[model samples]
Target: QFCVNYKNGGISYRSARDGFGFELDWTEFYTTTRKPSAGEVGALPVSGGVINGNLGIGTPNILGGSSIVLGDNDTGLKQNGDGLLDIYANGVQVFRFQNDTLESKKSINVTGRLTPTDYGNFDSRYVQDIRLGSLQYGQVWNGPGFSDTSGYVITGIINGNSDELIDGAHRRPIQKLIGNQWYNVVSI
Candidate 1:
């Protein structure tokens, strides 16, 4: 037998044979105008919503496996046994994380600045050419000047002395003439 009673601002249901009961709280339900808070236990908003807690999908034990899984169930982010995060695409592991290193199965294209915390090096066997907008020489070139009209070369001074071409510390100012006006290349 089954019974449903309206009480305590909610609908309480009970199964007589199983001796099990549950309550559907009215406060948990919300309309279009009423939205739940970030930490609230309620249905997510149709448009968008913020969750303040950890969300688990596909698995009840979120700590064991991937926290999220796409509709295909193959593409998702998972932490491996080594505690490194791995990114999967179409059931294939495309990217992975090692100790202080990021590994990718394909080529990486960066549009903006790629700054390294310390020193960075590239394999000469794989890297054929590297293009740069401007090249700055640490030491002054005492060799013959190139007559290449394709590129522009500007001569500058360090510490207001043209003879002191090299400034290891880069504490001096570097200036170049631009249409009769001198502009400081590096701010002091």
Candidate 2:
């Protein structure tokens, strides 16, 4: 049986079978004596409400398999059967979130600093080399056509090209420094 009761200045409706009912206190509604304007009759406020459960805008929650879906039917965020959160755009999977990992179909651009806590490896097949804008101090580079085995190093300064030295121990001619001059040491 359906019953309507007016008690304590409130109106309520109850179902006798399940004892489920709703009560509308008069003070909450009747306290505002002024009636709404023609435009405000069916209009809801833009803010000030708490939704405890899932909310769907243009599409239903069940149809999209997402807890919340925006106006577009193809775009939404859902947890897949694998327990991973997936983002969809235009009915295509764009991103997937796994354990500490985020996989994306498109490239990601970061405006701020992206610091990695751990070391990672890049595939040489996909990434040929890394280009940097500038290098810091104390860094060295090998010029083009430089070979490790055939490369030679200048030990000290030499006065001039005519000034050559003889190794006292080996009794052989070698490039040596006289005072503070520089010289080019060519590999033999």
Please list the C-alpha lDDT of all candidates, in the order they appear.
0.51, 0.49
Cα lDDT tens digits for candidate 1, 26-86: 3334335454564475757667876555454563333335445555556677777676888
Prediction 1 global C-alpha lDDT: 0.51
Deviation in angstroms for 73 in model 2? 0.7
Query: What is candidate 1's CA lDDT for residue 73?
Result: 56
Candidate 2 local lDDT, 1-188, one digit each (tens): 23334454433343333335544433322224345543455544455544555667887664354356777666778777676898877777888899878899777899999987643343322433322222112112221322332224323332333435422111112332323332323456
Residue-pair clashes per candidate:
0, 0
Which candidate has the highest lDDT of all? 1
Tell me the TM-score of each prediction against the true structure.
Answer: 0.34, 0.41
Give the lDDT of residue 57 in candidate 2: 81
